[model samples]
Target: MADSLGIRVFFIKGPASVLQGLRQAKLSADVDVFVDPARLDELLQALRERGWHDRPVDPDSRTFPKHSVTVHHSEWPCCIDVHFRFPGMEKPPRVCFESLWVNTETIALAGQQMRIPARELGVLFLALHALREPLLPACRQELDYLGELARREGLSEGLLGLAGTTDALAAVRPFLEDLLPKTTSFVWPEASVEWRNRVASHEPGSARVLAILHATWRVKPRMLWGALFPPPEVFLGTNIYADMSMAGRLRQHRARWARFLRAMPRLVRDLRGLKSSGD
Candidate 1:
């Protein structure tokens, strides 16, 4: 369907694409794909027609605009994360897709043509992963893969340059330096206080907080209000607190109200944290 719509799709940020031929890397369960944002509506409609519908998970609620729409098929074990922007970015970069498309390299996978990020961009992507979760064991493994790729492709300088462009060089440099020379038993080290502080400042939680503030106070006040108190149909359509029968719908409404009430304390705490952070 994306081909028919002329929407260029690229596999990104998953074991299938990122670790395709890398034997040592641990495989991930889901596939991540980036599509041109201009054709997002068409792509979404096409997906729905094929029985792939959105599943609003925890991350979707925490991060508003930056969240990817996860779609699933009952028969398929793996899910697809449809992204319009890079994950963890607060806002969409102006030329992200354009540049990525121009730099993309096509490869045949499972007897079908597919696009994946070129070496430089792929390394930059790995660096971004480190920024997102530097402490994870999986991230350390990813860094190992990245280090090998950089050495094999002579992409050290090019990757560093790309990181610099994203203002991520400071956060990503140490990982690359430490991981590149080692081949076994990778020992993860604690990030410096300064680096930790920098990562904290760029947290998506903070971004979500700012989004809520902007929606409620600065602009689009109605957006927040509407989200908090949307019509029943919106819930039904999204399969949130949904019920097929009239009696079930009435019960679901009451249950939803109770759930919201129980969740109020946590919501208040999150809001307070946002205010205290001065975001």
Candidate 2:
């Protein structure tokens, strides 16, 4: 559909890796396609016209600078994640896609020709994506897999050039430290607000905390209220409670509140530490 609209689209993340023979065992949770930022709405409308619907989400969650929008159909098991920009890449969305498009090559998948990032870019993005949640067991395994890829393909300075242009050098540095020149050590920069939020936790609570942290003095009270009593849609949109009954959804919200309360102290400490550093 996007192709008919003159939009250039390409796969990314898990599907891209699988299509390029980079990782056979990796499974895609959804179909992730990177589309031209300029035509994102047209592509989204096309999907909607075909019975795909956006996830039930609050307005704040749909704000700009977000990487992707997820749409789902009742009959499909996995959602379609349409991305206009990628997280951890600080370059303008159009510019970043343009840089990456240059390195993309055609591949055959599902009986159709598709474009995916080159092997080197694939390995780099794998590290960048895994490093988002460095402590998770799955993320740890991904980092380990990245090490295997690096060893097999060998490192390249050109990968560093791509990382540099996208301002993701500091984010992917810990994984690729040995790729750096030996004479001068690389210094890590401060982590961005979004990065810290991702690291703090993958919960709406983290977004609430961040909203409070960045809220002005005058709006702090309103933000505090919002944090305490977020819209029910915020909790309803999650897969955990999507199929649950009303009572079950309420229970899930209660459970989330308890977890959020328990995690607040540690989250504060982590965010404070991140204020002065980056991972």
Candidate 3:
């Protein structure tokens, strides 16, 4: 349907797209794809008709942009994460989707022609992991693969140039340096204390609420109130209590309240830990 509608789609960020045919590449549980944002509604409808159902979107998740969705079909039992933008950049890169689309490469996969980021842009896409979470072992492994590809293809200069243009050189530098022969196991570079604090401050849920309260309480006092008492439909859906008798609704509310009370101790502990961490 997307092809019929003239919407461009490209595979990205999973084993098939990033690690295809690499001996060290681990299999990803699901496939990731990016599509034209304007065609999102049409894509969603098409997927639904094909037995894919939408998963709830967590409004506070900072990991993915707002124009992203996950859908699953029972027949395949693997999720398809659809994105209109790349993940985990503190801000959007200077590079844009139009340029990426213009440079995509075609590849044969399972008897179908699929599109992916061209070599230079592909390295940039994988480098996002370093910026997001450089400490993770999986991310380091990906960097290793990227570095090997760059050297083998004589793309070192091109990759560095692209990274510089995208304002991602700072994140890409350490990984490139790791490619140099070394005697030691790669020690994860420590993010500066200020950087760590900033990342933590922007974390979703309660941390975000606190930051908003601190920065704009007088101008938008409603933020705090909304955080504390979000509409039940956000979680329970509009029809949660629709068909229930008064007695049943009352029982459901009581049960929910009991669960909240039971979770209070853990919640308090988490809050204390956050405070201690200076976030």
Best by TM-score: 2
Using Cα atoms with residue i matched to residue i, what is each candidate's TM-score against the true structure? 0.61, 0.86, 0.62
Report how far residue 19 has shifted in candidate 1, in Å: 5.8
lDDT against the true structure, each candidate: 0.61, 0.74, 0.59
lDDT of 1 by residue, 1-279 (tens): 677778888887565444444324556677888888777778888999999977655332322334357788887877788877764332245456676677678777767788888767766665666666665677677667767767787777676555545444455656556544455343433443334433443332343334555443554565455544545554554564466577976676677667666766665665576468663
Clashes found in each candidate (C-alpha, N, C closer than 3 A): 0, 0, 0
Give the alpha carbon lDDT tens digit for every residue of 1-279 in model 3: 577768888887665544443325566777788887667778888889988977654354322235467787778857888877664322252244565677688888867888887777777777664445554677667667777776787776676555545444544557556553466444443443223433343223434334453444474555555445544433433232243556755665666557566766654665567679765
Candidate 3 residue 216 C-alpha distance from true site, Å: 2.8
In model 3, the number of clashes is 0
Error of 2 at 255 (Å): 1.5
Where does candidate 2 stray beyond 4 Å? Answer: 19-21, 61-65, 184-189, 202-204, 240-249, 275-279
lDDT score for candidate 3 against the true structure: 0.59
Which is better, 1 or 3, measured by TM-score? 3
State the number of backbone clashes in model 2.
0
- Estimate, for each residue in 145-257, the C-alpha lDDT of model 2 and write its tens digit: 77766766675576677788777776777777765557756667665666656656554376567656766789888767766666666665676246366787678768888
